[model samples]
Target chain A: MEGEIRVGIGTDADLVIARAEGRAMAQRLGFRRPDPTLIATAISELARNLVMHVGHGEIIMRPIVEDRRSGVLVIVRDEGPGIADVGAALRLGHASRGGLGLGLPGARRLMDEFEIDSQPGKGTTVTMRKWRLRDDLERLREKRQQRG
Target chain B: MSVAILRKGEYFIASIQSDLSDTEVLALRDDLIERVGRFRALGIVVDVSALDVIDSFAARALRSIALAAKLRGARTVIVGIQPDVAVAIVQFRLNLDPLRTALDLDEALALLELRPERKPADGR
Candidate 1:
């Protein structure tokens, strides 16, 4: 929780904040080109989903580490009328709400891992992560730089 | 101002300065559409190099801007999409059909001047 950041998604302005923060965090975690941009785009989609449908939600971002790989984890949650059919929502080009219908599926394609949980009448929670691995030479260079 | 709109000759140029909110994005679209009709411009260029992320909503808004401007008898060319941003857009599989793009503002201006009659293939 030390490195976790939570942003309230109550308005369109909040989406801007979440996207910038996600991109910054990804860059700090050493995510290479395209990954940081991808993460930021994914954050935008999830935050927009809340603003469009539920009108309010929260996005949590934190650095993750596992098995010699470092990554960023993003969790978006909203307390509103949940999805009736998760499958339908994830299906590309199916605009359940007359929008582009690409938010969920597009975010899924941008990240390495994705999971969504929704209960009709309850709420929806989405968790996604993107990882980056440092190769041996890069690790050695980092060690050398640390020594100096 | 998040976006700057300038007039050069017969075209209107709207350059987005930074990341924009949904409301601002829509506002830019509406503003451009109205300007195209009011000015009776021949072409319009939208610069988005400052935007690091172009998600589905932004992407859709762009296409809408192009189509609406076209309806007003003005050609629209999008300029300055960063390389990383382009990659993310492709991965998202966002539909940007009918929206012409140029590497920069100069090319966009040239594109409008080159072919004034029919739609040309996408410019990278």
Candidate 2:
């Protein structure tokens, strides 16, 4: 909980580093197989976005606890030109550049919770969390009840 | 740094061993294109099973590589996308429809081998 991994994203290599760190952190937090992959994929998307748009950024991975739930939190911040229209940016197939245009929206769908803050010419910050412990416990209970 | 491009008869197989950077992806695209031409390969099978995470950049790169291979007279098949990566791809609507897909390398090879157009003019 106290140890947060911070990865700098400048080039494409940094994207891989960020994803590896994210996956490892998720696993350390007791996330299941798919959850760790999801977290890693989400981090990859965010880090790639920073490299493409801002040219440089940072991703922070930390563990979070709320009530009886535990999850991993990812925060990506960049000092690049911010999105002028957040809604349009989130729309599918909306790309100002040449990429697939699914970075932000895709990352949003992968994580349990997602939030973004940006100001034109200022910067952008994206925060996402995936809660696993509670969900896994709930799934186990469902399986046990079905066996009864 | 160099993605292996193995030659299996007239087919080219590229197995991604680790998470790739954007530059590496581009290099792969170029390498595959060059190999398809150099080997006169009829099909390309890209194995992504080892990659736990694929972002939009990599997805786009794969799509472009497939398209480029097609233009070079080679079919492309992406094999072994994990269930989680598949879910994220569909949820984000990353349009990789142009590239053919298979469950694994075996299926991909079988699909390529079975295609009538892929057979030699002598019917081998």
Candidate 3:
């Protein structure tokens, strides 16, 4: 089964709503307690960036299942001025405007897999995936049993 | 908006029961600062037990509030940070080291009570 939710980011209230929606979606997708929080935090960072930089943006959260693994995927898109240096932006403690500077790297570290694409004059799209740890452990156990 | 700042003896307690947006966080900072001055509180306890997620903006606001309270002769303690939230903060490389933290509200109160009387020369 696949499910998706879209949230528009325009103001600080939108950030809170986005976080709540992201957390709820992750939970509905069978993510555990902390995983839901992580997803929510990532969404907050992205939403805050959208409001601060682009003035508006969109966040899409979806559930995915591949092979025997299940996970949640988050996509954040913005039409703001794209990052001039993707590598620098991913570095910790690097703030472009004026904040903690944890927006991009922090989101990356919170998820299992992260990818970003940006064009100087166009926009930026961030895609992140977090796999279900229980499923991964179960798959590992199955592999061990098969080998034995 | 439901966050309440209560005065308990010489300490002020601000319990955040819901998710706060960036604007609310800023308002909280201003409110806390004003209350610290008005009540002449000696200590402040910020309870974030109900917050499932705290982004960089919220975290920074909390830190700034703590600093502002300190300048106003009030000690600040942050309590009820979830383990998952702690992990996320560390992963994000957010520095909350300057702020005093406790596991829960009870511990925070105990810690504040145990502190020696504020020295007049103890600036910062």
Instruction: List the DockQ of the predictions in order.
Output: 0.85, 0.63, 0.76
Clashing pairs in 1: none
Estimated TM-score per prediction?
0.92, 0.87, 0.90
- Interface CA root-mean-square deviation for model 3: 1.1
Higher-TM-score candidate of 1 and 2: 1
Q: Candidate 1's residue-wise lDDT over B11-68, tens digit each?
A: 9999999899999999999999999888889999999999999999999999999998
On TM-score, the leading prediction is 1
Query: Model 2 chain B: which ten-residue window has the lowest total lDDT?
Result: B115-124
- In angstroms and one decimal each, the interface RMSD of every candidate reads 0.4, 1.5, 1.1
Model 3 chain A, poorest ten-residue lDDT window? A133-142
Q: Rate the local accuracy (lDDT) of all candidates.
A: 0.92, 0.85, 0.86
The top-ranked prediction according to DockQ is 1
Please tell me how candidate 1 rates in CAPRI terms. Answer: high
Superpose all Cα atoms of candidate 1 onto the true structure and report the RMSD in Å to 1 decimal: 3.6
Error of 3 at A21 (Å): 1.1
Q: What does candidate 2's lDDT look like per residue over B4-114, in tens digits? A: 778999999999888777888888899999989988999999999877777777788889888888889999999999898887677666778688899988999999987
